[model samples]
Target: MAHRRPATGRVSTLSEAKASSRAARSRQLCRSRRKAVSCSGAAARQSCSRATWTWSDYALEEAGRLTHPLRYDAETDHFVPIAWDEAFERAGAALRSVADPNQVEFYTSGRASNEAAFLYQLFAREFGTNNFPDCSNMCHEATSVGLPKSIGVGKGTVTLEDFDETDAVFSFGHNPGTNHPRMLGTLREVSRRGKPIIAINPLRERGLERFQDPQAPVEMVTLGATPISSAYHLIKVGGDLALLKGMMKALFEADALDMAAGGAGLLDREFIHMHTSGIDALRADIDATDWDAICRVSGLSRDAIESIARGYWTAPRAIFCYGMGITQHRHGTETVQQMANLLLLRGNFGREGAGICPVRGHSNVQGDRTVGITEIPTEHFLERLDRAFGITSPRAHGHNAVEAIAAMRDGTAKAFIGLGGNLAVAISDPQTTFPAFRKLDLSVQIVTKLNRTCLLTARESLVLPCLGRTEIDVQASGRQAVTVEDSMSVVHASRGMLKPVSDTLRSEPAIVAGLARAAVPNSVVAWDELVADYDRIRDKIEEVFPDFYDFNERVRVKGGFRLRVGASQRQWDTPDGLAHFLVTELPLDVEREGHPYLLTTIRSHDQYNTTIYGLNDRYRGITGRRDVVFLNADDLRELGLEHGDRVDIVAGERELRGQTAVAHDIARGSIAAYYPEANGLIALDEHDHASGTPSYKSTPVRVRRAA
Candidate 1:
């Protein structure tokens, strides 16, 4: 077999390759560092030892330094470091001074542990507000909101073990190689079994096409990469919902044909009758949609759609996995529900090697939300929480990320306490988000690294450095293990081996506990004691959530345990006590008016979420630049533009506005741009009303030559 070589055309031993990669990475870092120092107009070769600096010294100096998380700073910004006791008093005073509990919002990041998140929510609820706007609101909120209506569970149903028995794996709108590298091992195993892996995305990612496992001896020695995508389809941006509907339509048609030929076992007639509803409505909708519309929107031919659907139907068991791509659209919630509907039609739920999987971006994002980081407060959960902590929990609904920013901008919200997150930089419409931060009476941030959010300083702002996941967290008791929940809803323990970067830093749990102790006078629960021993925190968790019964003991068992998902067991937790089907009216306009193209934001392979590891997007054949945009070859011809031509993209209606032009390999009638940079073009109000998630994937824009 003839093997393909990388563009560099140089092959070496695995060790040598790794060394070269590291060296190149190091050189880039050094150059960036030097440029940063030069830009700051400071002495490039200053010695920090002259200032008697400690690890925390650097953090203290850079606390409110950089204007934005993505920008560089020239001079160190000094902050008056206060004593721990003084900090506690200030925090408590700030909380007490708040005129209304509704005015204060508690923000959580994916970096928060289960214990800290639970405590943070408890403290906020007890403080008289349930305004827990977590990181999930910006990312996978659609999945959490959509899945329940479709199949009865918000979390993915398949366990890691199910991958072993999968006959076919369908992945969409996610890049696993960079976002979750651990999943590559599972993909490799599935490939070894000769199972077909289908990938549907606008970009042809290298990991989806081929991957070389550094841990494999045979593949490493042979200098080979495994082929991942048996069938790769480049669907147009925002076309996933249509593509999914088309596939289901094909499957239903195929099932009818099979039945006409006297095949009774082809479809799960029994399961459909017992476990689902609204099949007739779904069938009618699929029948009404024409083939031409599906093909044009999906950028796939009728034959291609049929072929993929045929393969899916032939498989005894399959798993459908998706990422932000499916959840960042105008119809993000509908997209997720369609995925659930696809699974349900085939009896995919409650079975081995079958289910819907929404790959979470952050390690502990799902866990934080599970432990009470939510805008919508549940009555039963709060009542149980009140019993456990001996405090009256607030029942008032609070703001999500979008509403929180709106509140702050309008002076409705006065104080903001971020448990862990880059709120100002992460939210849409920075023009409003940054100013809202400045308007806050008190802005408290507990973080591990420096980010732009810290620079949006309040009149009385404090930056408390905290421990990173890679660092050891030691409290008064001893070393500790923080717990997190995976995409599949399995709760597990994570213990850090690396030493703390700074002695002044505190654990997330400890920071939350410190604030709780200060804010709540004569608190019944021992905040400090819970921080010392995480098991006690889990005991409280078990009391509130019945699924976590025997939490401490169960977590000790190697894989941990899965939280109960009623949907997987054929139990619908909906208002009607049945899985309901929602009908979405498709837009008549196939393409954006006047503009010959559509635009979507994508992540580079070297990046994870908002963190850019390097400039190179190995999958897209790009190197050393993020400003470049992607365009389809046919679209380029249609627009009378060549490769690297500057094109402006205009987004927003009459009020909100933005425009950017860049050179980019995106599909015809579609354009691709990097996030955070493009995020400014989107408005805060432009989100799913039901889920409150930003429409990051499908932003209608007009493209033309830049003046």
Candidate 2:
């Protein structure tokens, strides 16, 4: 069992701890500690985080304080403790040795503060390279790229308050109870109010079906659970495009029928005419699409899909929420466009209670991008950055995650410096990614705890201990609060209550400054001055991005302010200055003939990203283990396998052997397994071209009983 810290308000007794394990199975079993690890993607986000118990799932408790800076020795296969200055000097030497600055890859994690991320990008550009491969590259990259072309903004348009007035909610491909447990409370309220909540997923997650408020003593006494998801539809893996198209087709058919009855059409013609363009192209594409193919590809009957369309048609205000299931595919960008089209038909944007919501993983994933963490830097942003720092930034495009891995594999990339995160396990196709890391000339990981990526030893690798978000950060100016941006646009300030976990542990900004000072000898910026007081960093940020005008004043005014999004006001900021109803072709062929099953990777209840707290998937009826594949009962019979039988999963030349098979209620021809462990079964190159996001949600594989 993983360690469980006592809740902030008061520690739960042993009876409650035992109850927690059982509660994991029941709908009312959800728990989120009310304390703030707040990193409001800080106006700089300063809002309190509504994340689960202890901020992370036993991550802080498991990795004890006092982790030392260590160097990986290949001869003894051990990590020996080294002084901080030595580690930084060696890292600087390896970076300087690289003939071409572009040979080094600089990566950032979502957990980093806005200040940390800004300095990270600044350091890389100062070192003369634009190579940045961050965590968003593997997830939500499609949302950041695809949403902008259609709506003029990449972030979600709706706020938390939107759920309050939404007449209906449509969710796809994610399990919130495990991913964002905080949102389940909002969902519970929406469901309690009698609004319709429709769910479309391959596997029927227990969290989306029902939830009981453990916080409400009334429910605890009565053992009453609130029912969620008014209607649940099982869509096959790689079926998002088809399902979205089918819904649009049904709406068009409904519009024609309504118009013929001598009444107002189903389409919001006025809103579409005034705020959008390219409706004709989208209409034509849907008209030419075959209903039979949509049904076959989506695995949903026409009537069933039409029923969902009716739910959308009847509701005056509706919000569409989705996760990697829609964006981790070859057609991810197109799928996002199609979703924008669906909401446009009803004028869902800029309105309360309605719009597109893409739940981003990690606290600051969106914030990192907002502060300029990208391989392709816009001319305007680059100019502003250069002007703010009085330095020249490269305008050439550089490698993303996929490109970085490929460059390393081909011996073109030589060094790696990670701001945070377990990138080695997070990225797919470990076969190629792991070896690429091993061959690097140097690697420097800035982290609080040990992870798989820390072990991917290069010629000279260093693991530098950093302060966790839960600990206080005192710079030369004394105790300072860091801001963070949430999935929503709101930024909040985070103040850690705990004392420094380790005397030697440094904050991310300090570590970044250390790296910058050691790596860029000719650097003009005063890194020490900036690190003395974070206010100086904020002032620099204000100069670079105009959104943060009154840098220090606005952030301290209560809750952090929200960044302005043009789409929120129905103001299209696209090249044409209008929202678009772009067309996406239906994806009919997804699997190879020999690949009978489609396997999708998922995180367990005990897991948060690549950090494993324990081995248990409580909601999926899994506990104490992760080596299990979930297959439909009928698929199990077809393959002559039983619930406890061992099997081998193959994708191309890669194989995951001796996996226990579990008979589940998942959609036929679809399989589910825990991520990172099953990452070997996915190909590194299998990703979306436009956004470069790996196809982890849907992969065709062959499953056979093991000897």
Candidate 3:
């Protein structure tokens, strides 16, 4: 039996030490067994062993080095370790020999720092191509494209402080416990304060249900988890747009009732009159939408929708937060706009606690876009950049991730340079994407770990290993702390604590500098000097973008500083002086589906993007393997399948001709499969027309028992 310990924050007691040991022993026991068992049953047996495992042991396990480091192989599939200098020279020559500037493409990942990202974009633009495909294209392109039309900016309006003061929190399509552990603390505090957290998702997530913060002393000691969501509404997948529209419709009806009762302060009439346009058109659309149609489409009854609207009306301030689940749909851009429309009805933007929050996946995805990693080139940014750097930045519009992949497969793109990210695993249509990668004249990757992308070798492939976020980066000028912008646009300094795993490992910035120096021999900037001290790079950034003025000094502050967003102050950056309202027509196929189901990809609790930490997904009651899919019990019964029975999902599209995935537990009609695994089933060109973001959420598919 495990002994109870004190909730004193520190793990010091002898019983606590003993409990951790037992937990490890149990895990070892489970691993030693060959047959598959229930994860809950495994947990029950391991509970005694878990108490014996220390936090350090868990950390070490997560930080284990790759047994086989990726290297360049000239002959077979096996990678042979080569010198860094040799790889760089070969990569530079291959890139330089490329015939056309448009033939080369550069990809950026969210893990890259602002300085490295800025330098990467500069290098690509100066190289005479605007083909800067980034990770943002896959995640929050909807928010980036939608929010500007609604609130004048692409970023979330609220800060960490706003979570404390808000009366209500509305979370849509995001699981804070696994994706962002820091957010769990905020939600727990809100739950403790008796504030309602309304969660709208198709599947009930464990993190949203109850979260046991490993950092919390009392919770950790008691093994108790705090309940997060006050109300959980399981809406049908791809029905978010209809659901949001229904909510707005309910709000309008409620506002009408308040007006009839002679209430003057029910709606923000002044804000609508002064700051917005197309109110009449929006009102007409809401009035035209029948409650029954809304209810049927959204998978919610009229009373239930009304109840949620009343909660919104009752709360003084509310924060609307969404994740990739909202942004990966076919109508993702319009869905985001609907969210904005709901917020605008209450005048949520430009306020302290009430605003839009698009929970970004990666650390610096937003920052990378801000620095100029864009397919759509802004003339103002380019003109300013050219003047600052004394080099002509590409002005022509270029390809996004999908477009780049298409170009590569079609033999239009000859060279591929990824600063960081697992392009092969992250992209859709691996069958075509892998073949395209192999066709590259030069394929250069700046990576930290061994991934599937590194295996797609080109005629001239090079892998430059870099320091991880947790690893110390020492240079000629001494130690350096990299700056990363969070989901809220808060740029903060992250100084590494651990030493580099390998002596040959280089900093991302240093590696970029070396490549830039080798590729462009007559370059004006002192690449080595800038790499020595990152402050110089920041200085260069300040020179290029005036918005980042005094970058070094400002980053020295504790939480760093917020980048100025002109839209927050009611400054419109659109073509017109005012925000434009564009009408979107929902596709008939999506609206009138007879199957009554929509599929969406999800990240497991033990995963981050494409990185598979482990097979067990503790939140969704899935364990041992990642092959199983989550499903509704009714849907399963209707299909004549059991929990453990395997089924093949064939996406109903010609482009996905040979794409079929086998999985189990997915909600009936509705299916939840892991991303990249399901990515191939989604067509390449099937994306949001406005933003060019692939429709990862709403893939129409037929499920059948596997042979």
Which candidate model has the greater lDDT, 1 or 2?
2
lDDT of each: 0.75, 0.83, 0.74
Clashing residue pair totals per candidate (backbone < 3 A): 9, 19, 22
Off by over 4 Å in 2: 1-66
TM-score of each: 0.88, 0.91, 0.88
- The alpha-carbon deviation from the true structure for residue 391 of candidate 3, after best TM-score superposition, in angstroms, is 0.2
Tens digits of per-residue lDDT, candidate 3, 275-296, equal: 7788888888878777777776
Screening candidate 1 with a backbone cut-off below 3 angstroms (N, C-alpha, C), the clashing residue pairs are 40-74, 629-663, 629-664, 630-664, 630-665, 630-666, 631-665, 631-666, 632-666
Q: What global local distance difference test value does model 1 have?
A: 0.75
| Top-lDDT candidate index | 2
Q: Which candidate is the best by TM-score?
A: 2
lDDT of 1 by residue, 1-707 (tens): 21222323121224345644654655554444333322223432231222312212122223222111121121434343455677777878988898898999799988888988998998888788988778899889999898877876688888888899889999988878877688888888898899999998887677777779999998999999898889998888888888888898899888888889888745677888877788899889989999898888877888988888887889999899899988887788988888887877888888888888898988889998888888886788888988988999877789999999999999999888998778776777777888898898888888754455765767666767677777888877788888999988899888889987556667788878888888888778778778888888999999998889999999989988899887667777887677666666554443667644556777777665655556566566655555556767677667776555545667744212222223333455677788766777678887877788887777777656655
Cα TM-score of candidate 3 = 0.88
